[model samples]
Target: MDWLLNADTNGEKFLVMLAAVGLFVVVMGAVLVAVDRPRWVPQWLVVLGFIGPAVLMLVFGLVYPGLRTAYESFFDRNGENFIGFDNYVRVFTQDEFQIVLRNTAIWVLLVPVAATFIGLVYAVLVDRTRFEAAAKALIFLPMAISMVGASIIWKFIYEYKPDQPGVNQIGLANQVLVWLGLEPYQFVITAPWNTFFLIVVMIWIQAGFAMTVLSAAIKAIPDDIIEAARLDGVGGVRMFRYVTIPVIRPALVVVVTTIAITTLKVFDIVRTMTGGQFSTSVVANEFYTQAFTRFNFGLGASMAVLLFVLVIPIVVYNIRQMRLSEDIR
Candidate 1:
């Protein structure tokens, strides 16, 4: 037990992991044996044997932590004194936090719409084309990269340097600006607009995901419906606007809601690009800044709770839309 508790070396850690896995296997084996005895064991007990571990895990891992965070939100920075609603009030009333909220709203609103739109358009244009696979692979490449890695890649793209006789703009964007004979602009350090530039990174990453999902939905549109639309002279833009969009509405909803949720909880890009400085912070980054960096547990927990609250509706709507789509099908 002491060795398992104090696993300092790599080998000891491996052994501890093996031990845990072994225990899990033993417990599951027992449960399975119990469940196999359907004649002897009650149906409810057999059912419990299958699902009980999962229910217990959800309670301990998700439910408890969520409840604890909500409880901590009412406490002070040190989490010792009670300060009901102050942190939430500060989040709304404070100018800095207002900016955070605004940025978050912008992200949730823009990323999904822009990414989904771009992806839908791209998916439509490239579908069944000669270069379809290549085009998709190109667009979807960024989705393969980790968020931090994507942010880092875009950080270089947005990098700015002074326009001097010998100084060269290394960033792709600044280089384009210089090519157009325009001064290199600060992408990450500037306020207000910097948030949009950060949002662009998310859009770029998510567009691939949106494209993949929407493309499949587009392909799944019944051939008979498409042929019928074409017979009605519904071609080109009208065909897309009327026939395609209506058919893939559910996928669009799922894509938009999923992206919105991702955008709502975006932290890596902002943190990596600007470290949430220069009025570019969103709720997730702000939560980290408050709770972990500033040691303001109460405010941090409030931000987390606020994010959770925002996400719940989107999740519910996504699920409802999925069910409705299934029903329609």
Candidate 2:
């Protein structure tokens, strides 16, 4: 038991993993055997046999952690004293956390809208074009890269060096400025606008995802609806505004809300590029910085809860939109 608990060695860790897998297999096997005896076992017991483990896992993993974090938010930094919303008050009122909230708002506002727009336009333009696959592949390439990898790639693009006589600009963006005979600016370290620069990376990565989803949605639009619109003299932008937009509205909402949720939880890009410095921190990264780096458990838990609360409304609205769309169909 001690060895299982403290598995420092590679062999011990592998053994522990095997033990867990074996235990899972044994438990599942027992459940299946019990369920297979339909005549001997009650129907409810058979249903429970299938669902009990999953329910237990969900309760242990999600519900308990969420409730625990919410409870912890009401305590002090050390988590020893009950502070009762003080941490949440600091989150809303403090200048530093105000900046964090502002940055998060900016991220949620811009990334989804900008990414979805670009994707929709791209999808529309390249819908049936000759270079459609190639163009889509080029745009979707960024989605294949991990967030940390994408951040590193963009960090190099925005890399800054002193404008010395001997120095050459390695960053593509800085090089463009140099070519234009303008001095290279600090892209990441500069406050406020630096946040926008970081946001661009997320947009670049998510634009591909938005395009993929919206493209499929566009393709799913009935040809007869488009034919009817064309016969009615609707063309170009007007056709898109009326026929295309209305047809894909549900998909558009899903894409936007999905991206917004992702944007709200954006941490890797900001953490990798700015480390939450220079007013570039969002709620997710700020939570990590508070709980882990700064060791302020109360504040961290509060931010976590705040993020959860913020996401709930968007999620509920997304679900409602999806259901409404389904009902209409």
Candidate 3:
């Protein structure tokens, strides 16, 4: 086992990979044999053959890591000493980490709400437009870009230069402010507002996804219901409110929660744009900062655990909402 882990050479790494693949094949072959010889093997064994590997993988990959992280969260910086609850307490009580939590809350609250609203509105507006596909594509283009790429794009979009004589403002935002007879604003260096600005990039990236999902949901609204509403003089606002919205409310919930989770787990944009400085640090970014940058495994693990705790509720709520929506349907 020690030799297996000490594969420094390329040949050794290749052998390790080959061995892993061979092991997988062998396991599958054994399972298939058992499944084929069903009379000799119990029916449950066949079922287990199909599902047991996946369940075991989950236990090893997801469940075990999660449990181990939780356990490590209770230990000290090096994972050698016991320091129960202190790391968690520091995460909440420390001003900097508190800022991280606050920023995370802001990201979770604002990004999903703004993105969903923009997407819903855009989806509705372009539902049956002459250039519907083009319009949707324009909105959705950002989602195609990698988060790092998108961040770089927006970094230029929000670029700022000192308001000095003969100095050209390269950032679109500052140029807009300059056009309006105002000084160039340092978007990333400012607190609170900088966080909001970083959030706008995420919203820009996510709105298209929301639009795509909500658009399908909107289109799926029964024509009879829409026609009935129109016959009763319920057009425009009334029709959309009573017919379009309620019918797609489940989808809207799904979009919001999906974006919320995505926003919660966001790290690249903050890292790229501001490097999590200027009070714009979120839990995900801070987790990286702690675990890798600071090398405080205990604190990092605690942050990881906190993130897990925070995500669990949102996920549970999403699942419950999905179930309720299905039940309603």
- Separately for all candidates shown, the number of backbone clashes (residues 3 or more apart, or on different chains) is 0, 0, 0
Q: lDDT tens digits, residues 1-329, model 1?
A: 78789999899999999999999999999889878986898999988998999999999999999999999999999999999999999999999999999999999999999999999999999999999999999999998899999999999999999989999999999999999989999999888899999999999999999999999999999999999999998899999999999998988999999999988988999899899999999999999999999999999999999999999999999999989989987
**How would you encode candidate 3's per-residue C-alpha lDDT over 1-329 as one tens digit per residue?**
65478988898899999998999899899889878985787889888989999999999999999899999999998999999899999998998988998999999999999999999999999989899999999999998899999989988988988999999999999999999999998888888799999998999999999999999999899899988988999999888898899999989999998999888889999999988889999999999999999899999999888888888888899999889989987
With a 3 Å backbone cut-off (N, CA, C), the pairs that clash in candidate 1 are: none
Task: Please give the ranking of all candidate structures by TM-score, highest first, separated by commas.
Answer: 2, 1, 3
lDDT of 2 by residue, 38-64 (tens): 689889999899899999999999999
The whole-model C-alpha lDDT of candidate 2 against the native structure comes to 0.95
- Local distance difference test, each candidate: 0.95, 0.95, 0.92
**lDDT over C-alpha atoms for residue 71 of model 1:** 99
Off by over 4 Å in 2: 1-19, 326-328
Please identify model 1 stretches exceeding 4 Å from their true place. 1-13, 319-329
Q: TM-score of every model?
A: 0.92, 0.93, 0.89
> Model 3, 38: alpha-carbon shift in Å?
4.6
